[model samples]
Target chain A: MAGASFGYDPRRPVLRGIDMLVPRGRVVAIMGGSGCGKTTILRLVGGQLRPQEGSVRVDGQSVPDLGRDGLFALRRRIGMLFQFGALFTDMSVYENVAFPIREHTDLDESLIRDLVLMKLHAVGLRGAAQLYPNELSGGMARRVALARAIALDPTLVLYDEPFAGLDPISLGVVGQLIRQLNDALGITSVIVTHDVYESLKIVDYLYFVSAGRIVAHGTPDEVRRSTDPFVRQFVDGEPDGPVAFHYPARPYAEDFGIRAS
Target chain B: MTSVATGLRRVGAGTLRAIARVGFAARFFVAVVLQTPAALRRIQLTAREIYFAGVLSLVVIMVSGLFVGMVLGLQGYDVLVKYGAGDSLGIFVGLSLVRELGPVVAGLLFASRAGSAITAEIGLMKTTEQLSAMEMMAVDPLARIVAPRFWGGVIAMPLLAALFSAMGVFGAYLVGVRLIGVDDGTFWGNMQASIDFWPDITNGIVKSIVFGMAVSLIAVFEGYDAHPTAEGVSAATTRTVVGASLAILALDFVLTVFMFRGLGNT
Candidate 1:
């Protein structure tokens, strides 16, 4: 079958027309190595940037149909755990969690506090209420950003490299929280990351992007046996063979292999 | 593309873009005006900016004013004494301080200290993506960040300008009446009678407010738009300080011309 394609470019589709549906209450992982546009797909889906061709629809509204206010409201419905948590260093933990509620709603102080505490509790950070973002460990900061994300009870949550910088223990804790929260909150989840084995263990289904396209999609067992060269090489994380070195040569270099230095 | 077409488009877009950006700035000051009723609501941050703009600026304003007053006194005395109107030293120092020198000098001090700092702070925040985080979380950065500062500088400039005028008069009094051996009573009495409140003092207050808004607004705009890269941040910071300082000087000239024209007849 021809690879159906469209994405940031019209003439050359980023996704090659591949399609993957995210059900409302399941966790799906999109895995790809660095420079594979994994984060671009997430940004496209999350409305950070518009698809250059075709469309991205969140709950039937075209991404561009949303104005600033609409996009803000749409984003509030989707929690994002940005790389390294992206917590504002200026706000304390409680205030970070309370930020969305304060902006989007007119909840009274008591109600706002109650909601912030609940999200913090769910993330196992109820005790860190008064702490500033800088005071938290990597795992704790990610959890605080997670808590802030889920403060408004979003229907879908996007994790952009949630486990990128965590230690093994912290990674395990975060992986488990994603699973636990998925089950407990009944929220659809999309994780964009490169932590192959750990991500396979946590996710229900997998989509792999390569060269700005969704190269593979399946259950864990199906993807494990795939023969696609790029997919195989990526899953194996090999430094050589098949994938080949494609680094940018210097501007003055005459040919690809010539080492100008 | 034809050169003429490109040039025309550039000119057209540049004009519109500047107008829009200026409107963006005007909106910020308007927001500050709107929030004046709730001045007590955001008291802490406003007070912090005020203290930063005011108390920390005291030394610079005083020293600069003393020197400025002394220089203006000497220059005005020299020029007037050539006509044997040495008695007009009071008129020279008092009118210059109240009408022009006072506000511009205080604003220059502020443009250096507060203006550079505002630009750098906002530039750092921009490069770090903290400003984006604020927007995503629905923080009205203009209301929270820029507005307090614009108004704080506005209030601070006049207060500093008044202090400037006082010190300048004192400096002139020292240099003119004592050192130059002019009559003390005539100098003192002439200044009091010649200095009118409306066109001189009120005009200083008005220009300083405008100067304060321009300096703070340009600094924040340039800083908030600084790129994440270090080179961009440095460029933005430099641009902000230079741009704000130039803008203050230009506006002071324009306002002076229009102001004296309007008041000259009266």
Candidate 2:
């Protein structure tokens, strides 16, 4: 994406003058505070949203310029894991993994069944294939979503907060799987997350955004050793930094109705 | 004077918003219709919706139909007996059920049951991001989800209405002839002679179909347009029920006025 700017309301832009890139066969992570337009970037890439200015191109094709058929064709080559799994509750694990294949191909049920099982096996959840999403633990559900995301073996996979709301063990497991999957499938991965430590461990490159602008971009080692206050605050997990812990407010004394002492 | 001007402005703004909402709903309805062919190509999806929207509501519709019919029979008998026309009780119950109560009441029940269910399901799906997930997978949620439910209601509405009318006539028979001592022959003979297939039965079916379209369209549109939150889904479900009910009654009145306009001349 180059100079991408977008907002649900045009007058209040959520992303402004953004440029980011994901090279082939690499893992990149974009980190930011809540509501900083991280997920909006993912939507622009998937063509779920169009940037108001500048271009979002994937594999030499501009996303916003594509018609319905073209956009769908482009999306076929991209997979996304939402904040939660977002698995179809009505479908079983095996069926969830099989959905894209069934919708995109004319493979027989027998062939689809084998592909679904293989994907489930890759996620180490083959035994849980018949289980519904609601029946799985949060970690296990995210794993199933990982399997579903790679079912088509796309060139690119986007992860939106892949480690949110997880126990430590689950978080480690997910972080490892993301790295392992990127190498194994030779697929480029772009993750949007605020999990600083985990992303530092796996990602080849990092982009730190603040209030819709890229404040810092570096390799993980540079990010850790750098003196940039924003990067320091994020890496050190400080209570207050360039981004204040407190929202803008009136004077404390006035808020409490206390006269000056 | 300033306050009154503000009030007038508020009213004008509300009217414009309402009109804009209606326009958006009309466009959504058209999109659903455009996707109907794709929905029908995979008939099982629509069949599943019919089971949810129509088959599931059967017991309520039938029971309500029966109770309404029994009351009509008792009331019609009381009124006719005063004029020494007690034999006309079956005709009264049959006409009222077939022409008005069956479609209107069945529609009201369906709006509360099936229409609300559709909205809640779709709204919940939105809340959970399943619809967004589908879109990201390059699957159009409109074709895969909304169109099937829309067509299912359209196909099932008239059938349910017919069933309601049938059950109602049976209930009337039980009350008017079996209990009230009206001659069975006179009851049957009178109903058969007075009820016309085109004017009464067909017109009723037509009304039910229109009600079905209105209810289904409102339900799907509300669901598709719901805010992606629990409270939003709840509010959308409430709107579906209320909006569908109002649409059914208002459409029924307009249809009745047109369909039975020739009653005085006849």
Clashing pairs in 1: A4-A16, A4-A17, A5-A16, A5-A17
- lDDT, model 2: 0.93
On residues B1-266, what C-alpha lDDT tens digit does candidate 1 reach at each position?
Answer: 69999999999999998899778767755766675644546776778778888889999999888888889889889999999989989988999898888888788788888887777777776665556555545455666666677667767778888899889999998899889988999898888788777777888888888888887777767776677678887887788778887888999989988887876643
lDDT of 2 at A237: 94
Model 1, docking class: acceptable
Error of 1 at B72 (Å): 4.5
lDDT of each: 0.79, 0.93
Per-residue alpha-carbon lDDT of candidate 2 for residues B64-108, written as tens digits (9 for 90 to 100):
989888888898899999999999997899899999999999999
Residue pairs clashing in model 2 are none
lDDT of 2 by residue, A1-261 (tens): 999999899888999989998899999999999989999999999999999999999999999999999998988888889889899998999999999998999999999999999889888899999999999999999999999889888999999999999999999999999999999999999999999999999999999998889999999999999999999999999989998998889988899999977
| Poorly placed runs, candidate 1 (over 4 Å) | A1-18, A241-244, A248-261, B1-59, B70-87, B138-160, B170-185
